[model samples]
Target: MGREYRCRIQGGPDRDAIRQLREGIRLDGQVSRFERIRHQGGRGANRWYEVVVCEGRYREIRRMWSAVGCRVNRLIRTRYGDLVLPRSLKAGQLRELNRAEVKALLRSVDVSHSGRRSSASSA
Candidate 1:
């Protein structure tokens, strides 16, 4: 599961464009689920969208949006796999991941890395 995002696009997307984007995403076959996509609001030529896609599918989501005549100007991943970017963590700040967080992150993408121990032992 993932949270929604508020994205800024070059042009406002109408309902028909959103429909086309949905179709494109489905055709891409990389998305397991596109939970939601809506025009939250906009100003001038910039459009705001609230989108919820399956975890690990943000790239596909961006591609689909582009294919449907929307150029994404900015995107912020509000959530990923039960982890939310903390409000206090400003840009460029670093936060070390705890063991559980690391484990969950790896599990989200179905990846298992045994770390540098195996290489060290071999060396």
Candidate 2:
């Protein structure tokens, strides 16, 4: 599973570029899930707008945008796994999850059911 990110970027990318992204492009390995959000004045590849991606590959977002010729001005992760970052949370503030929240998050992944063990795990 991959994390979801909403990006606000500078530079404009057009339909063909966006489609190429959604269809999948090779970043580090491969990255997909590119969605261009609709904004009031959004038209061509020169405005700041939102693009959503769901891939946690190393530097995938920035690299992907750069590949398509868009410069990411801002990147925000609104969701990770089953946890959603609250809108009320302010910048530079940290919130520790309560015990229950932590447990729920761990449970959401079901690591125990992933029977294949790595060499480190087998040791």
Candidate 3:
């Protein structure tokens, strides 16, 4: 599933630089999708981005931005596929997903029922 991010970066990265970063992600064969939504704040430094990749590659987003010469000051994952981080869930707090929610999440990521059952059973 893809994720949306609001990132605070140090340098003002132009469109060309952002394109280069996208290319880098593609070259690495890691990212399935990469998009820069917009840059706000002074000098267009802070950016909003959306990316789709195989699971467990969230950290790579920071690395890719850093490799392109932008230091990420803040990175907030606002969405993961159909799951949005609830405003009520404060940092360090956890929320358990109900059965329907869990099923939807698994469907979003294309996980088979057997896979889900096996994982659940193991847990």
By lDDT, the best candidate is 1
Candidate 2 is scored at a TM of 0.66
Clashes by residue pair, model 2? 12-45, 12-46, 13-45
Q: Which lDDT tens digits does candidate 2 get at residues 1-123? A: 446666666776788777777777776564555644433244355454545555466777788878888887767776666788887877787799987777667566543335443455456
- Model 3, span 1-123: residue lDDT tens: 666776777786777777776555543565533544455555454554444444436477677777677778877767777888886777688889889888898777667777754454345
Mind giving the per-residue lDDT tens digits that candidate 1 earns over 1-123?
Answer: 576666788877678777765554554555344577877778899888878776545466567677678888887776667677776776677689889888887666555585433443455
Global CA lDDT computed for model 2: 0.66
Local distance difference test scores for all models? 0.69, 0.66, 0.65
User: In model 3, which regions exceed 4 Å deviation?
Assistant: 26-37, 40-58, 112-123
Between which residue pairs do clashes occur in model 1? none
Q: Clash pairs of candidate 3?
A: none
Predicted structure with the largest TM-score when compared to the true one: 3
- Model 1: residue 115 alpha-carbon error in angstroms: 13
Off by over 4 Å in 1: 23-33, 55-58, 88-93, 97-123
